[model samples]
Target: MADAEGDRITLSALQDTQAIQGQTVILPTALGVAPVETTGDPRIEAGWFDNGLKRARKELGQADRSVGDERLPVLIVTRYLVDGTLHEDRAIYDLGFALDGQLLGGTRVRIRGLSLITRVPAASGQAKLDARWKQLHPKLAS
Candidate 1:
């Protein structure tokens, strides 16, 4: 479904995501084994505008500007969950995961690459489902 429309993340995909919701997702940094939450479209999120038109544009002709990354909105626990932390600013980072499952008779998962953009305060920042972070930390990339 790589070329599928951004909205093509179907019920099956969502259901499949939820089915693994209870599973542990480990972020190498401070964030650790947090359960999976709802997911966004598993699109090749290329740039700032992670959702629609803008990202598509980058893919079409702006390869030079494109970070060429991938993202999926996997809501995991962060410093925000804690009442207070060292930094209140939001932070973004490239991340990865190691998932053990079965696809056709067994589970098949492949990662092309990963990278980190920036990081924000644990309380207010959000984590992008980028491949960069996972690339650096293989254990994190799944």
Candidate 2:
């Protein structure tokens, strides 16, 4: 949707699916994951996940800037839950269950990207959904 000035526009997903709703939409940082250390302890795998989350948060913050001279809204959905098979490179932790089967309650979505980890609520039909998203995920805003 375009603002009153018509120079800046806001865009967001219209679908309610987990893939579209929960995905931590971020711009690519590196071409791919850095070369894995062959000799490192298997326990370091957790560290890799932590580093990835940090990078994803950083990139999402950059994408939240307003348009033109005015501030526009940007939404960041994290830990988005999905029901289908994600490709090898795309899959994060397997919730190991169907989206419908799980009792998500207030949890709207969950995203686990290569370097991103977050969750967001199902979008309310608001013009300022982006701003609301930022409000909900303060860490990403930082």
Best by TM-score: 1
Cα miss at 61, model 2 (Å)? 2.7
TM-scores of the models, in the given order? 0.23, 0.19
Model 2 local distance difference test score: 0.29
lDDT of 1 by residue, 1-142 (tens): 3223232221222222232212122232322333333333223222222223223323334222224343323323222212222212223433321222334443222233333455434444333433433443233212
Report RMSD (Å) for each prediction in the order shown: 14.2, 18.4
Name the TM-score of candidate 2: 0.19
Off by over 4 Å in 2: 1-32, 35-44, 62-92, 95-142
The Cα error of candidate 1 at residue 91, in Å, is: 3.8
What Cα-based lDDT does every candidate model obtain? 0.30, 0.29
